[model samples]
Target: MRKSLISATAIMLFAAVIQSCNRKAETPMVHPDFETSYWIDIDLAEHPVRGYWRQVESLDPEEVSDSAGIANASRLLAEQYGANKLYVVYHRQFELDDARRIFIHWKTEGERNGLEIVPTVVLECYSEPSAMNFSDSTICDFASWCVENVNADEFGIYDVYIRQDEGSPQDTQMGILREAIGDKLVRIGLQPGEDLNSYCRSGVEDTWTAECQGLDNELWANPDSVDGTDLYGRKLLASWVAERADSAQSRRIVWNMIPVAWDYDKPVDDRGYVCPGDDALINDPPILGRIAKCHECIVEGYTDGMLTEKFGGYSCDLHILQANSAGHPDSISFYRQLRNGEPYTGYFASAMNQVSDLYKEIATFKQAKSKK
Candidate 1:
């Protein structure tokens, strides 16, 4: 009788342990606290993988072909696992500072998924004039920038890919550009295949360049090699953005500054003028105006503000404004506006007053002197 009782107790304990293990195993892992939208940075060549994950299935059983379907499906999976927002930094190619800015953005807005470096396939898209830029290895104009700025410590390891979604081009290699970025990528259900070895065999010989160091100049200059435009350099914007989120003492805010001219037929305000007036007027008519119409305006075009205005609210996850001569910045005022996702439409100088106070409150003791 004694032996039987002991045996029964042991059996019960074993069953309990098994049940606990099963429950844990069944519990989904990733959490979803961050935003649900993702900005994909795929090259034109990786269509197979993109299609597999983004297309193919209807994320919602009821909805047919809504754009948010895949995002919703991914969100559901994340909820089951315990994850947050699904913001993606989609750069066919980006520089070091840009990657850092992206990291800073991740820190501010989304659940940190650590850093993922994985093998991927992508499709390449380019204009007719740039046919010479494509090759089996990588694009030409962007290569030097990649060689200079790509960093293992900052961006992490990734298996690069060339996508071929549209019909293959005459130059087959033009459709592919393969390299690895970082490591945390998993073969989620919507992905293409599972063979990790399919990527580059030897892997990245190096990530960062010894020549690339300073945060001041190179930080914002979008590689001049790719496009001749001044719009690519991301320095000041990245700095302000990074400080807003990463600084523990600081508050984050959203500032929406659209030109009165954007609503052309509508009455113009006393804010600012339309930039390159004719060009912007033709492209985005409603957003352009003359300096005579609005005297107090700051920067003229959409480039004037931190966050990009979309159809409804701002597109960027976070927002910020510049400082003033009085050593003020609009951190708090903007924070208040965004506390409940409110819209901010104020004068640049006045807004700077709010930003100045917020900056002082959030700025570290070390930076306090800078304000003075």
Candidate 2:
């Protein structure tokens, strides 16, 4: 009987270990697609965890040396916005080889008046593309790494579309590109006589046409730097950032605002038309509107240069905005300090007090539970 009990106990322990592993793997992971520039949460149980990317430290206080221009942009933003308690969402680009990792192509066709027509094509899960050469240095591979390290639940991917210069969707190279990628895809049929020139530069119709079909899965479809009103572009970015609240701290919003200018010589379509200008700073005026609606608005600016320049750095254009609420009275006062460029000593002290009070409450609750 003693031996039997020992065997049963061991079985129980083994079962418990398996259960624990399953739980750990089930934890929700976050992902952000750079092509679409949106955030998504993926339940590991629901989807396979293929790869991930890491976020860059856009705002490191240590990087702000005394000699750096605007000496205290980091300190200033922190003082005004509660620096120690901010959330930094980091993500990297997709490497070409990683592109090979996920190759799911989908296709569908419909018959209209005795003619078959295809409407949509989708490339859902693609692995990073392999580097063309060993010397080829790209950021795409880092995206999967970032997703894994950041523990992201959702991510965005980009596909381009090319309508024929004058012919209908059937004549476009998109169909060929879809076939090249694989079979399972979501295709977007284009209207005849559509202006296809805007989709890409010379000798690149196949590339853009493939990306354009995967609009359903995207938050921002054709992201352009110059045209903020591009239906699937910047607006989608604003919405995606707002949706991923659980990843950030409680009562904090993370905004990924692109800068208002161009940073490279490449064609606009190649880089989602990232223009750095004030006109595109989201339609919300007073700047604090997004934060007021949500607990946090962490904006990711889209300028390519040292973040310290008055307009380039995050603190000046892409920093957090404090919101006023009856429950968060201290937050309102802290905003005032940041606006004045003063220190946030009181804000930090208030945070500590809240933490201490929470510990006491937990201790009391545990004691009460023990009595029961």
Candidate 3:
């Protein structure tokens, strides 16, 4: 009887171990994408000095010199945006290899927000060429579903389509798009008979096509032409294209095109296109409007460089800078000044306040228990 009891106990322990392993396998650990890590590092760095010079003796020399302050500040910023907790949950519950499955999971999470328990979530996914075939109708179906389900008022989807093929013919490539998406195609920056390949070519420095040039001119002439409605229309089409092109099997090519729109009452001019400074356009024109406007903007690629420079200042609250990555160091310096309660005016001041308000809202959301 003692030997039988010992055998039974051993069997039970073995079964429990197997079950634990199976659970872990079912939910593989996840980690932040490469771009997320890069941005996090940038956020943790000391604010570079810019504009004014002031000399103040440190009361606690050790505290002043400690690098952890920067990291802590970054953590606080992430927490305010809910990105930190979002990433934590994502890392524990999902894996990156399965792009389609991950995207569906993200959309489902967004839907859960309708119940008012889950915070409205944006899922940004990176796909390899192997997992995508731009000619597949199934991918288009998936994109259409996502677009239909996306509650623009609450949930958002940011997908980064990575392509590997270097030099494919314009029509040939675009033909696949037309075939896959059918009537869903919404052309932007391209005129009838003009192929996307002719305008934007890979491996070329002067890659901007004639259509791109035309769009730039039109935007400069009339900022309202690229307003919110126009931008969102373009984004919806782009999302479909991205979904069709993204595959886990492809290699070497990646395209990130983010379309954004601004709604403002102030007049915009060429100066508005430049990064805000003392020399920036007068009245500051709110730079890019408010953070809420930015929330509505389509985020393409690894960052918002295109939207910030060519289009205008990005009102995206999550981004610390209004300009491209190149200007981040300078922007960080300005941000630090604003944080220290230094005097600011124009668009810069307005943007800072908007971010503050957004942070507060997220904090409130975090504290509230979900109905679910």
How many backbone clashes does every candidate have? Answer: 72, 100, 19
lDDT of 2 by residue, 1-372 (tens): 999999999999999999987865543222211111111111101121222211222221111112221223234422233222111211122223322221110001001111111111112212343111111122223333334432122222222233234343323333343233322222121121223222221110111111111122232333433444453333443343333322232121122222112222333344433332222222112211222111111223212111212111111112112211112344433334433455444423333223223323333433444454
lDDT of 2 at 322: 25
Give lDDT tens digits, candidate 3, residues 53-102. Answer: 11111111111222333333334444332222121111101112233344
CA lDDT, every prediction?
0.26, 0.26, 0.28
Candidate 3 error regions (>4 Å): 1-38, 42-66, 78-289, 294-349, 362-372
Q: What TM-score, computed on C-alpha atoms, does each candidate reach? A: 0.23, 0.20, 0.28
lDDT of 1 at 137: 43
lDDT tens digits, residues 252-335, model 1?
122222122122232222211212222222212111222111111111222322122211111111111211111123333322
True-structure RMSD for candidate 1: 24.7
Model 3 CA lDDT for position 129 = 17
lDDT of 2 at 64: 12
Question: Evaluated with TM-score, which candidate comes out highest?
Answer: 3
Candidate 1 segments whose C-alpha is farther than 4 A from its true place: 1-11, 17-113, 117-123, 126-372
TM-score computed on alpha carbons, candidate 1: 0.23
Instruction: Give the per-residue Cα lDDT of candidate 2 at 278.
Output: 24
